[model samples]
Target: MNLNATLFAQLVVFFILAWFTMKFVWPPIMKALDERATKIAEGLAAAERGRQSLDLASKHSAETLREGKEKVAEVIAQAEKRALQIIEDAKLQAKSEADKVVAGAKAEIEQEAARVKESLRERVAELAVAGAEKILRREVDVKAHADMLAAIKQDL
Candidate 1:
C-alpha cells in the first residue's frame, strides 16, 4: 500500500473523533449501563427472596390448616364421647328409678296380700262360729257371746 496524504489526514480525523467520544460520551454511557446492570442484579435477588418467602408462608399455612383439622377432629371425638357418657348416665338413672318403683310395688302387694289373708281368716272364723251355733240350736245370750268373742280374739 502506498502511504498517501489523504490516508494520513483520514487517520488524524478518525483518532480525534475517537478521543472525543471516549472522553465525553463513553464515560456517561458506561456509568449508565453499569447502574442498569446493578439494578437488574438487585431486582433478581429481591425476586428470589420474595419467592422463598412465599414458599415458606405457603408451607406454614398448610401446617396450620392440618393442625386446625386435627383439633376439629379431636373436638368431635370428645363431643361424641361426652354424648355417649350422658346417654349412659341417663339410662342408668332410668334403670335405677324403675327398680325403685318395682320395689315399692312389691312392698305394697305384700301388704295388701297380708291384709286380705287376715280378713279371710276372720271371715272363716265367723262362719265356723255361726255354723256351730246353728248345729247346737240353742239360743246363745248376746252378752255371753260378746265376752266369748273378746276372749277368742285375745287368744288369737
Candidate 2:
C-alpha cells in the first residue's frame, strides 16, 4: 500500500467518527451534566432555606421566653402592691376598733362615778337626820322650849 494514500484514508475515517460522536453522543452527555449541576444547585439552595427557618424559629422562641419572664415579674409586683394595701387597710381597721373600745370604757367609768356620787348624797342626808334627832332628844327643857323644838324638827 502507498503511505500517503493510507494516511489520507485514516484521516477521513477519523473525521467521520468525530463528526458522528459530536452530533449524537456529546449532546446527551452535556445535557445530563447540565441537569446534574442544576439539581445540585437547587439542593444547596433548599438546605440554606431550611437553616434560615431553624434560626428564625429559635429567635422566636427566645423572644417568647423573654416576654413570659416580663409578665411574671409584673404579676409579682402587682401582688406585692396589693399586699401592702391590704396591710394598711388592716391597720386602719384595728385603730378604729381600739378607739371604739376606749370610748366605751370611758362611758362606763362616767356612769359608775355618777352612781357613786348619788349614793354619797343619800348617805349624807341620813347622817344629818340622825344627828338632828339626837340633839333634839338630849335638849329637855320640857314645856319651856317645846314649841320652838317642834318648829325646828319640822324644818329639818
Candidate 3:
C-alpha cells in the first residue's frame, strides 16, 4: 500500500467518526453531564439551606429555654414574696389575738374585785353590830340599829 494514501484514508475515517460522535453520542453524554452538574448544585444549595434552618431552630430553642428560665425565676421570686407577706400577716394576727386575750383577762379580774368589795362591806357592818351588842350586855335590836349599821358600813 502507498503510505500517503493510507494516511489520507485514515484521516477521512477519523473525521467521520468524530462527526458521528459529536452528532449522536457526545450530545447525550454532555446533556447527562450538565444535568448531573445542575443536580449537584441543587443538592449543595439544599444542604446549605438545611444547615441555616438548623441554626435558626437551635437559636430559637435556646431563646425559648432562656425565657422559660427567666419566667421560672420570676415565679419563684413572687412565691417568696407572697410567702413573706403571709408570714407577716400571721404575726400581726397573732399579736392582735394576744392583745384581745389580755384585755379580756383584765376585765374579768376587775369584775371579780368589785364583787369581793361589796361582800366585805356587808361582813364588816354585821361584825360592828355584834360587838356593840356584846359591850352593852344585851341583844341589839335589829331594826333599831339599821341606820347606825349603814353609817358604820359607809365609814369602813
Candidate 4:
C-alpha cells in the first residue's frame, strides 16, 4: 500500500465539515427542542389550572341551588302558618257573632211574650167590667158594685 496525498486531504476536509455542522446546526436544533418542550409544559399547566377552576365553579353552583331551595321551602312554611292563623281568627269571629245574634233573638222573644201577657190581662178586665154592668143594670150602688166586681175578677 502506498501512502497518498489525496487521502490525507480527504481526511482534513471531513474534519472541517464536521466542526462546521456542530457549531452552526447542532446548537440551533437543541435550542428549538428545548423551547418546544417548555411550551408543551406551559400548555399542560394552563390546562390543569382551567380544570380546577371549572370544578370549583360547579361546586359553587350546586351550593347556590341548594340554598335557593331551602329559602323557597321556608317561605312556603311561613305562608302556611299565616293561613292557619287567619282561619282560626275568622272562626273565632264567626262564633262570637253567632252568639250575639242568639242572645239578641232570645231578648226579642221575651219582650214579645211580656207584651202579649199585658194585652191579654187588659182584655179580660174590660170583659169583666162589661158583664157586671149588663147583669146589675142600675140596681146597685155603682162604687160598691165596681169594688165587688173587681174582687170577684181577682178571685177568678
Candidate 5:
C-alpha cells in the first residue's frame, strides 16, 4: 500500500465517524444533560419556595402570640378594675350598716331614759306621803286627803 493513500483514507473515515456521532449519539446525550439541568433548577426553586413559606409561617406565629399576650393583659386589667369596684361597694355597704346600727342604739337609749324619769317621779311622791304620816304620828286617811295629797305631790 502507498502511505499517502492510506493516510487520506483514514482521514475520510475519521470525519464520517465524527459526523455520525454528532448527529445521533451526541444529540441524545445533550438532551439528557439539558433535562437533568432543568430538573435541578426546578428542585432548587421549590426549595427556595419552601424556605419562604417557613419564614412566613414563623412571622405569623409570632404575631399571633403577641396578640394573645395583649388580650391577656387587657383581661387582667379589667379584672383588677372590677375587683376595686367590688371592694368599694362592700365598704359602702358596711358603712351604711354601721350607721343603721348606731341609729337603732340611740333610739333604744332614749326610750330607756324616758321610762327611768317616770319611775323616779312615782317614788318621790310615795316618800313624801310616808314622811307626812311619820310627822303626825297618826294614820292619815289617804282617801279623804286625796285632793290635798295630790296638790302636795304636784308641788314636790
Candidate 6:
C-alpha cells in the first residue's frame, strides 16, 4: 500500500466522524449544559431573594421593637403622672382634715372660756350681796357705806 493513499483515506474517515459527532452528539450536550447553567442562575437568583427577605424581616423586627419601647415609655410616663396626682390628692385631703381638727379645737376653747366667765360673774354677785348686808348691820357712816357699795359694784 502507498503511504500517501493510506493517509488520505484516514483523513476522509476523520472528517466524516467529526461531522457526525458535531451534528448528532454536540447539540444535546450543549443543550444539557445550557439547561444546567440556567438552573444554576435561577438558584442563585432565589438565594439573593431570600437574603433580601431576611434583611427586610430584620429591619421590620427592629422597627417593631422601637415602637414597643416607645409604647412602654408612654405607659411609664402616664403611670408617673397618675402617681403624682394621687399624692397631691392625698396631701390635700390631709390638709383639709387638719383644718377641720383645728376648727373643732378652737370651738371647744371658746366654749370653755365662756363657761369660766359665767362662773366668775356669779361669784362676784354673791360677794356684793354679802358686803351690802354687813354694811347695813354695822350702822357705818352714810358716806363710808356708800363708798363701800360703790367698790362692790365696781367688782361686780
lDDT measured at residue 72 in model 1 versus the true structure, 0 to 100: 100
Model 5 stretches with alpha carbons more than 4 Å out: 1-43, 127-139, 148-156
Q: Which regions of candidate 4 fall more than 4 Å away from where they truly are?
A: 1-50, 131-156
How much lDDT does each candidate structure score? 0.88, 0.83, 0.89, 0.88, 0.89, 0.86
- Clash tally, candidates in order: 0, 0, 0, 0, 0, 0
Query: Compared to the true structure, candidate 1 yields what TM-score?
Result: 0.60
TM-score of each: 0.60, 0.51, 0.67, 0.56, 0.60, 0.50
RMSD of each: 4.7, 8.1, 4.1, 5.4, 4.8, 7.6
Any residue pairs clashing in model 2, and if so which?
Answer: none
5 against 6, candidate with superior lDDT: 5
Per-residue accuracy of model 4 over 65-124 as CA lDDT, tens digit each: 999999999999999999999999999999999999989999999999888877776677
| Better candidate number, 1 or 2, judged by lDDT | 1
Error of 2 at 10 (Å): 20
Q: Flag regions of model 1 displaced more than 4 Å.
A: 1-29, 112-138, 150-156
- Structure candidate 6, residue pairs in collision: none
- Lowest lDDT 10-mer window, candidate 5? 133-142
Q: Positional deviation of 39 in candidate 2, in angstroms?
A: 9.5
What TM-score should be assigned to candidate 2?
Answer: 0.51
Better of 2 and 6 by TM-score: 2
Q: What value does the lDDT take at residue 7 in candidate 5? A: 88
Off by over 4 Å in 2: 1-50, 127-156
lDDT of 1 by residue, 4-53 (tens): 79998999999999999999999999999999999999999999999999
Evaluated at residue 140, the lDDT of candidate 2 is: 50
